[model samples]
Target: MANQQVNRDFLFRRLHSLLGVVPITLFLFIHLTMNAFATKGADAFNAKAQTLESMPFLPVIEWVFIFLPLLYHGIYGMYVAYTSGYNGSKYSWGRNVMFTLQRVSGVVTFIFILYHLWTAKVLPDGPSFDMVQQILSNPLQYAFMIIGTVCAVFHLANGLWGFLIHWGVTVGPRAQRVSAYVLMLLFVVLSGVGVSALVAFHG
Candidate 1:
């Protein structure tokens, strides 16, 4: 029984990690790319928005592909963060940072997502260019959005390393170390794109 429970938990953790990557992280990239359209101008951004928002069955897609996976990943991630043996002091500097940051950013991302969705999706303005611009124009809101973007992006990028490891794809210290550096670069690039999009909207 004890062994079964442990096995279940181990499998759950992998699913939780996997969800963070596939639709969750992939959606992030698409979101950032769409937002990046703002850099070109409002017409470009709004047109792209229209294209996406007009997609048939977008609501279902959002719920099934994006929101469902995110909901599970965030909830399970919070559970694991609280219950796992993730002692920062037990591991080396790399593991220590990964463990601590994973928990911290997971919490931040969870809290931030509600505010983000409320502002970005639930507003009276909908997904229009003016809607995003109006919200980001507020300096405090701008800061919060930037911070939230960092947390969300970092959580995914960092967790991506764990996902590869969990799947036995990147086994061994040398591989993980190399992957960490690569993912760190990915995090920075994604964060830059997200922040830049916000900045464009702010203008």
Candidate 2:
């Protein structure tokens, strides 16, 4: 009975840990796709953004759906990494590289997201489509945006790889080896599409 209880508790904890990733991953995919619309024109991007904002109880929904999930996922992911004896140097080269990339990119994405929200979503006198055009027209904004997009893509891909492992799909030596290359390739393609969209918007 004790052993069964322990197993149940362990399973619950793992599920709780995983719950953090799901909503955030979904939101990231949707957000990346929507932001891609910016490539078309300011009007297109604004229309999408405004439509989202105009939804009933949008402010409340944003807090529930976006902010809360992100906070939990980011914080819980870091906690899991810390507790799981995750050592970058001990893993295979590809695994180590991806692990490091994910950590660094996660931090970068968090910072960029915070800044984006502050400037684009929260501020009282924040910029409009014209202002965004002017800002993004600057070389600095362009560079920062490119870096942020790359970081976001890498983070998402890396998280997906980790999720697979957690769900028992990629176990042991051979599976880990294969997953690394696959995830890396996927990240490259995803980031390429994202960056292209941003560039097209600016052009």
Candidate 3:
């Protein structure tokens, strides 16, 4: 029974790590790229939005490729976070702090994604550049966007490194250290693009 439970835990952890890197991360990349179009001008953003909207079975694609996987990954991640203990205080290591921050960011990013989708996708106004600008006109909404973007970027970036470690892709300390730095650079670039697009709304 103990062996079975251990195997089950291992399986779930593997699934959680795999899902985070695959469809979930891919969706985030596409999403941030689309939002970065805002930096090109609202017309460009609107054009890209309309083009995406015009895709056949796009809602089905979203449900199958984005929403369902994201929901599973998020829920399982929350469970893992709940089960894990935060030892950053005791360990006082950079990786220990990042481990705690990754879980914290996961929770925040999950909530942010839910509210973001509800407002931008499920609302009667639909998802348009003008709609986003109008919604972001309020200072509170703007602040939320910034917080959400940063949390998401951090979560995904750090999660990428964790995924590699969990999957045994990066075992040695040197490999892990190099990957960590690369992923941090990735987070900065991704967040910079996202924040630039967010600020473009002020125009």
Alpha-carbon deviation at 15 in model 1, angstroms? 1.5
lDDT of 1 by residue, 47-123 (tens): 99989988999999999999899899989988988886766776667778778988999999998998888778786
Regions of candidate 2 where Cα sits further than 4 Å from its true position: 1-20, 77-92, 124-128, 172-178
Give per-model TM-scores.
Answer: 0.92, 0.76, 0.95
Best by TM-score: 3
Stretches off by above 4 angstroms in model 3 are 1-6
Report the lDDT tens digits of candidate 2 across residue range 86-184: 467667676676677777787788778777677566764533456555656889877888898888788877777777787898888788778877978
Among all candidates shown, the one with the greatest lDDT: 3
Give me the overall lDDT of model 1: 0.88
Candidate 3 TM-score versus the reference: 0.95
Off by over 4 Å in 1: 1-7, 85-92
* Candidate 3 lDDT score at position 116: 91
Q: Name the candidate, 2 or 3, with the larger lDDT value.
A: 3
Residue 24 in candidate 2, Cα distance off native in Å:
1.4
